[model samples]
Target chain A: MSQAATTIYVPRDTTTISLGADQVADMIQTSAANEQQRLNVVRNGSRGLYWLEPMLEIDTDRGRVAYGPVMPDDVDDFLATECWREQAGHPLYLGLTEDLPFLKNQQRLTFSKVGLIDPLSVDEYCHLGGFEGLRCALKLSPQETVSQVTDSGLRGRGGAAFPTGKKWQTVLDTRAEQKYIVCNADEGDAGTYADRMMMESDPFALIEGMTIAALAVGASIGYIYLREEYRLSEEVLNAAIRLASEHHFLGDNILDSDKSFSIEVRLGAGAYICGEETALLESLEGKRGMVRAKPPLPAIQGLWQQPTVINNVITLATIPTILAKGPDFYRNFGIGGSRGTMPFQLSGNIKQAGLVELAFGPPLATLLNEFGGGTANGREMKAVQVGGPLGAYLPSTLWHTQLDYEAFATVQAGIGHGGIIVFDDSVDMSEQARFAMEFCAIESCGKCTPCRIGSVRGVEVIDQLGQRDVEFEPDDPERLAQKVLLEDLCETMTLGSLCGLGGMTAFPVLSALKHFSEDFD
Target chain B: MITEMNSTEEHNNGWQASVKRILTELKDKPGALLPVLHAIQTEIGYVPGESVTLIAESLSLSRAEVHGVISFYTFFRSTRGGSHTLQICRSESCQAMGSRELESHAKQSLQIGFDQTTSAGDITLEAVYCLGNCACSPAMRIDHQVYGRVTAEKFDQLVSALRTNVIEVK
Candidate 1:
């Protein structure tokens, strides 16, 4: 065995960083240097098995071996130059990294190079089949590029599941003085970090994806409207953009072709309403993030009154691979109309909370049971909220529902951003229902009266329902009538509101009431 | 470690020149107001109420318009906070992992509500919806550093560490 033949990987993902990967990396480097060792310490992005971070991975002859949930104290023996090692004796060791069932079971398509490579290394990115999609896109006509994506059955991974090709084709066909491609990176959902992961881990992929979109839709300039909460992402993305520009992946005349495109990373202040594409555009234009009435979609007129394509970060990031491999190759992975894999986020009260990218059609039970390892406190799992706070709080009865958008819709649930937050048996469903209303009231943009007024009324009615024995004023409705009133308020918010902030806020509240009626009574 | 708020007032003395530097650097960029405001905040703690007029003039927006934009978002603060801004995540995932109890513990230990700084002027607590550290739930961010899997005891230790560190820095 060669003495200098080892590379150590420690994740630089936000979660891992918070968990002390930096300290672990520093300690390992110091220990290695003390032993006169020649080792490469690469800060890679996360593989999404967050529970095992600061997970330490080493390059062995067999493959990458994993050891982790490692503390700085446990890193000393790693650099003990005994000509390599035994992991079975180590308490933190978890055998070969890929062999772990959690990672082994996942169908990681977009996240292929996340924890394996330096996110900003354009050279490493190219070696791992990175910009092959953009190269492939460069050869095809813009119209043909759009056609191939349509054939791939790729829809927006950003909850709405809009047909990506249709959105692209609109911009392609539009007659415009200027055009824009805006990537919605404002990932505000509580349990969802897939966008952040993809951006942090393999940013080149997103750049490549956006470049392909630029080629497809004839957009010269792109803007990544990232949220301010993601400080790490801002740093990573800006560095990646500079590197991409230096390498000729971005800027005027890409790869010496007639095509020219550029990208800018713009940060959004804290407003959940800005996740809506129109509101995002308004924010990009330095206006308040209020939802606009839809008749002219963002594709028709967006970003300084020009043709635009506004896609979610994940949706755009998935573009490179689809073009690299073929429509059929990507299309073969998923079931029915929900083509391709989704990075399903499992968080909250689960034992093993992390990102699990799977082909569509897996039952929710699979994610909750096979991937999540059940409840964290060894308690019975009572409910799970699929999607964001706006999504439904599903009971165990609906566990059989597939992860597909259509399947979720059948059960009055939306797989919105593919985030499933688990709740244990001790949860008060009435409180959960009330929280949905309260959240709506807090985040409402006040563009419409129904959302602004109805949400506050929704909270009042739910509170009244919870305290059924209270003496009612002459004007106050009875507990049973209050329940009916809450339902009516939710309906108004769902139908009358302009965007998902007001429109879909009813999903969780109504679902909680429908599934856990006993909690209300 | 408890310091008076006078230091913040003293820091504000140079803010006019600081705001000018920020305005001169970023005012011409596309959609410049947000970036300019963010820069001023980074350089001078929060967006000082007076700087709004300077920003408005530079960006060619009315004072009311600039203030409207600032007030629209929870992140853009008009007043200067304590030495550090401590934002605890209150979203669903964190709540499910016992952030509510952690939040109450934080309030009790610090003797302050959300959005209110203590008399010491060393720590300011705020409630944020999410920090995207859901996997290791019950998360909080102090300045730009996000910490996860935080319990009541952990919160206490973190504050104590911050207190000691801030004293050493000053």
Candidate 2:
């Protein structure tokens, strides 16, 4: 470790620095150069403080001193005063980073390295203790490695919250000539950029995680099926793969262990349905994005009819931690069966909308109030959408529910993608319900009738309710009945659709209707 | 940069040149229903009809396809563009929080839309599908910038201040 006493942490979040972080970073570098100070500068991911970034942190006797909302012009004065060491007042100084209750109270696991390292630099990754999982996995027997993940209780972060280890173990147990590892980087969920941020900020972690998956599954080739919108992340991740290949972290004879694994990236054309495992596999094979029937699930016949282990970006990214920290360490953080931290994306109308990695079952109220700082506009909280478009809308009455996967589900909601979107009193639950149906209508892959045609009809019904047609008055018993019918229609879509694209929409729409019926009017 | 130009140059081969020449030949006629723009795009690569005249002469009709084709599909762009045409879906499904307004904002900011161009010519803006990211809705793409749940203000600032040169010229 370079014992460089002076290191600076600057946040590179766009929302935080309306003026931009690049200019501030350059200013810091230039000032550091003039002073002949050996400054270890890292363009860490956002600390989720959209209000304060380009936030500069300096090491001090008290703790890591913090300054933020820093602009390029202020860099000179920031250094000239050396006030950070003295705790002298500077307009940019937002106080010690660890003291911020928003960051202090929360647990960080999946996002441990975000906004803390150069996302592209392997050296920075190594310094921050990345690839430790890969190192551990290389030592463990394949079965032992699989067992470790199983013991960790880490579920998929990709909405379903499925057990990741079991999914990988199924592939390992299968006897097939060709097996594969596919990273579901197709993060189509609204109010969620955890996958994108991770890919852009720590591509190696994901790559390292995927490499381990390939080893455990007896697979040789790994594919990262990234959405086309994430072009920059694709470039960064590809570059990291090339670097990892050169360093023997990937490619033939990885880690000199006789295990050969090579990873490649495939871009998904604009298709929300492609986020589904089977649909994603189909798109990878050059077909129009459409869902495929499961049961001959992806684990058995996926990605060109090969037994493939498909995991979301965050799920695979957590592999290194599970291996490095031991299953018990990884499993001990969260409540009940939902162990380990979730990379929860705080977005939409929230005040401090950004990625937050916290233990499961944190009260949605606490998440919104303590960490998120409530809705951005400071209006009365009306409804909060947990998960994505298909996620349920938790009205203010249900705000006390714990945010664990099962707990949220108990209330007819799921923490799909761990994205919490806040809506103030101004939000109309009726309009939201209608929008959910409209969204499903546009996104359904036309593979299954229940999802395709049903979603379109669902939208029409919601529109009818919105327009206040003579058929159903707002407060009429028939209106409630119509809502129930729509909910039932959603249920059929949930059970019948090929994937979450159609399934998840029901979660939010139904919850909105059930919890906040008045808003629908 | 090399990859972009090589692909464009490769796409601009004899077939495309021949198509461009023919389109240039039929520059004028009443309504010139050659549908030359789409026909030329199909014949060559994309709608290379930079001007109304080029589209007019290409097919034996007037520049109707040039106008009609440009307006018909969301794909056509009159101005020269970067290698990738990143069309972000900005319809109602994506517009619950203002994607409808975002489309116009993106067009004005990008200095192009429906069939326009940015001064940089690196990206061409067009409306796309739910982009299959409706869960995240209000999504945008620029050869790969899949920003979701974006606001009009954020979109405007991102476009106005984007430093596309982040990628090194390989």
Q: Choose the strongest candidate by TM-score.
A: 1
Residues A1-521, candidate 2, lDDT per residue (tens digit)? 45454777766543333344667777777877887766766666666654455568877777777786676677778778764464457777777777877677768777787766767777888898888888899988889999999999999999788898899889999889999999999887777778877887778889989988988889998888887556567777888899999988899888787988888787664567778888778766544566787789888888778899999999999998898889999989999889899977765566666567888877888878877787666777777788877788888778899889778878888888887777777767787887778778877777788888888888887776666546555568877777777878988988887777777778767887788876657
User: Interface RMSD of candidate 2?
Assistant: 10.3
Q: What is the lDDT, from 0 to 100, of the residue A304 in candidate 2?
A: 79
Per-model RMSD to reference:
4.0, 8.9
TM-score of each: 0.96, 0.79
Mark the regions of model 2 whose C-alpha exceeds 4 Å error after superposition: A1-7, A12-19, A30-41, A60-63, A71-87, A468-481, B1-170
lDDT of 1 by residue, A1-521 (tens): 36564788889989999888898889777766886667678999998999898888888888888888886666665555332353666778899999999999999888888888989888899999989999999999999999988998989987899999999999999989899999999999889999999989999989999999999989999999999999999999999999998988899889989899999999998898888889999999988998888869889899988999999988888888889898998899989889999999999999999999998999999999999999999999999999998899999999999999889989998998889999998888888888888888888888899889888888888887888576555445576687788888888888888889878888989888889987887
TM-score of chain A of each: 0.97, 0.91
lDDT of 2 at A374: 76
lDDT score of residue A474 within candidate 1: 42
**Can you tell me the CAPRI class of model 2?**
incorrect
Whole-model Cα lDDT per candidate? 0.89, 0.72
**Each candidate's chain B TM-score?**
0.91, 0.48
